[model samples]
Target chain A: MTQKPSRTQALYAWLDERLGLTTINKLVLDRKVPKVNWWYTLGSATLFLFILQVVTGIFLTVYYVPTPDHAYDSVNYIMQGVRFGWLVRGIHHWGASFMVLFVFLHMLRVFYMGAYKYPRELTWMIGVLLFVLTLGMGFTGYLLPWNQRAYWATTVGTQIAGTPPIIGPWITRILRGGEEISALTLSRFFALHIWMIPGLMALLIAVHLYLVIRIGISNPPSKDE
Target chain B: MSSHNPHDLSRRDFFKIVSSFVGSLMGLILGLPLISYFVSPALDEQGGEKWIPAGPLDNYPVGEPTLFTFTLTKQHGWEKTAQSYGVYIIRHSDTEVTVFSNVCTHLACRVRWHDDVSEFICPCHDAHFAEDGTVISGPAPRPLDKYEYKIEDGTLYLHLVEG
Candidate 1:
């Protein structure tokens, strides 16, 4: 005689019927691949760090003010006033550094393995974009505090961006919103950091993940291939 | 080979419990403080009131209501802003002085001293006030609000009540 289904089993069945959970489980989770070493873990690690950054970032925005007048003080308040705010901001801060590091290391791994060639070329291109996006995240996030370091660092950074001949000054003007890094520049940087860069990164990441899963991870190459 | 312990909990059932428990626990831990962080600003109150110096008491001529404009450094959220304010100082004599808030009692419009009308005129609703700050006419609910003042070493200090 067949036993009755348990509550958990019934609930899962109810969800699986409508959501196609079994198809997802089979395709995304249970699919088999070639045996890989520790190096394959770096990509996943970078993705994990990005998720951590996103979580902490959403929390930080609740208290963070973007204007020049309040940016530094708001960050200072996050450090001292709000409960567990330090923890949230700390993770977002260090997670950004670690995410950038992991993205680079992951790229290095892919490069060393010759996995960027063949059917995975598109994936490699997207991965490169993700790498640049990760750096962009770091660059924009660094200037948000509006402290002395942020001010001068962005000043020099935009100046450097402007050094490449005809387009240089135009690029600096676009970034700084004027001849100097003023309140408008601060607000513009704030907008880019919180919305534009990350928004694009998130879209790229979804496509990147889809490409990785669909194309399947590349096999560990031998000298012959 | 097919003979198994029927009374034992299945591994799948055990994992379901563990996953649900761990996931809910993590959500609760992170979710509660996030709510507090966002709502903290809404619930905050400014610390207290203190005396803000308007100007020297001797500077205003007797029997004339002169405008005294000053700025207060206000701490709001993470911002410290200098908010400008205007008041009218009517010095009756050396020992007695009355300070009226320039803000109208009706809709908080700035009332100006009109020499032709001989009354403080609120441009917004045309409310008028007499020399002593009593409501002369129009939609003002009451007399103009007065600032409590204390003379210290011949200086006029306005008692500022914090919100």
Candidate 2:
């Protein structure tokens, strides 16, 4: 006698009939990766750091106040009052630096391996944009603590933005929302760090992954293609 | 089949058009509110800049810049917190008062008053400011900021704006 289909199989088949999820799974899972060394893992490590940032960042926002008035005290409360808040925040902080580092290392590996050339040009371009987004995330996150260093560093950073040329003052004004850094600047940075850059990063990351899967990971440079 | 009505819409095309319209309308409905919410913080005026009571005017003596520590209750948007502020209140006379911020002009490091050395020293970079808050010998591009102050009813109040 024939047995009934398992629940998992039934649900998957029902969805797969409409979504072609099985084809997707086969496309993603059945692919062959290059026989590269462990250096190939840097991209994955960077992705892991991004996930860590997202998780820890969500935890942090539960208590963190983006306003300058309460930002420092809220951070202090997280450190002193909340259980393991320090650990979560510490990981988030260190994870930001780690993400930047890992992305840089991944790009360097890709560049040295000549992965940016040929059909992978778009991937390299996306990688560069992602790298920039990663750095933007770091720069914006640095000010969330609302400490003295953050305040002054942001001041200097904005001033640097104001040094370009005809658009320098405009750049600074747009960033700071005025001639100087104020609560608006903090809010702007908070929004950019938590939403804007991360949103763009997520979309680009999807595209990057799609391109990677489409083109396949390039082999380490050799005389033969 | 060849005698179909000209204005007749196919089911699939009708669904596609209706769904597209509904999707765009939903996106607009959701996106406008979110954009407004995101931009509202910037639009709301930061209402913390005001004159805060520092202390009694008699607490400061003549010729010596006394450090007056005060707590400012600040409200920025929905968040409210008390932040500690310090300023050196120097009384040249009964009417002349010069209040210098303890924050170093270079990098905003707290400057310490050293009576023994007769100079305000920023420990971060070993920068020194004179008793008059001049950049005596240091990397400080400018003198310590002179905070605005007002005396009312023998009470000292600082025009606290930016840190």
Candidate 3:
């Protein structure tokens, strides 16, 4: 006859007994997740878009120069000299547009489905912050080109910021780094786009996911409730 | 007295109904796309970047700025890509020329040349740049960036920057 396992082995066996692979597989394949409308997939899509951004962004960082002087030349080199440089840049550019688009749609779906209620409120709020960061990413990324379009767009965007009361001028000054958009502005935007915004977004997204899993999926509105 | 209740469905029968319903729904959703993802790329051509010729110098008038648009293919690692860029070229004299990117310095707004004012203007924020590419009166911090240009036998060649 086969001998029984030792105490430690038995403990491991008991733990596995409580949550066995077969049982986990059953949970995943049993369709225990709610079978909601197609809107339920936007969250996963948004997450996918984020992954794309990170990947493309990393490739872009390889060739992109954060400084003002070399920024334009480097981008040109990528366009003209680098092998498949235009495609990488194009994907990065268009990827940003798609990210913003999908993120907005994701938020709208969540709102319409009443996913923001009660236990999910924090998750929704974090998502809202992420949306703002997405816009920030767009704004900052636009300036990196150092082209006429980037220059003018920054002017318009910053001027709009100047319209707000009290801290408008201060904010503008901080953003521009003096009286006008210059090297300082480029550096500031570079920092925010590459580091600050991405960092904050990652942290917030982690919290958002944690809250989502901890609270479980929110149910759709019922007639009785 | 023994009685049989026909209205009650057995546990196994109920489970069969649920399983079949879920299976059919999943099949309807995932069946087509999963197969396509595996088979599509193999049937398609090997895609890569292509260099497109922009235009010649004769097409651009002297003392007047002209917008040159071109589409170029870009390769992003394992992926293929394409995008369009617009460049504003001004021929100051026969050999002296200046090329300014159409993208505005402020926020990436496309700047238009105003012949009346002899300046590049960004209507989005009223940003202005001189004909020489200096920032004039608007919120723009710097002048428009000049592209590396070459005239080979009168054919104007411009270097495009991928962003």
Can you give the DockQ of every candidate in the order shown?
Answer: 0.40, 0.03, 0.02
Q: Write model 2 residue lDDT over A1-225, tens digit each, in one string.
A: 399999998998999999999899878866788789988999988988898799778777877898977899888876765556667788798999889999999999998999899899999999999999998998889899999999998999889889988999999999898988889999999999999999999999999999988989887887875
lDDT (0-100) at residue B117 of candidate 1?
Answer: 71
- Model 1 chain B is weakest, by summed lDDT over 10 consecutive residues, at B1-10
lDDT of 3 by residue, A103-138 (tens): 999999889878899878889999999999999999
Q: What is the lDDT of residue B136 in candidate 3?
A: 88
- Which tens-of-lDDT digit does each residue in A39-143 have in candidate 1? 999988898888778888988888788888788889999888776787788878889888989999999999999999989999999999888888878878888
Cα displacement (angstroms), candidate 2, residue A179, comes to: 1.3
Candidate number with the higher TM-score (1 or 3): 1
> Could you arrange the candidates by DockQ from highest to lowest?
1, 2, 3
lDDT of each: 0.87, 0.85, 0.79
Per-residue lDDT of B116 in model 2: 96
- Weakest lDDT window of 10 consecutive positions for candidate 2 chain A: A77-86
RMSD of each: 6.4, 21.6, 20.3
Q: Assign candidate 2 its CAPRI class.
A: incorrect
- Chain A (alone) TM-scores for all candidate structures: 0.97, 0.92, 0.85
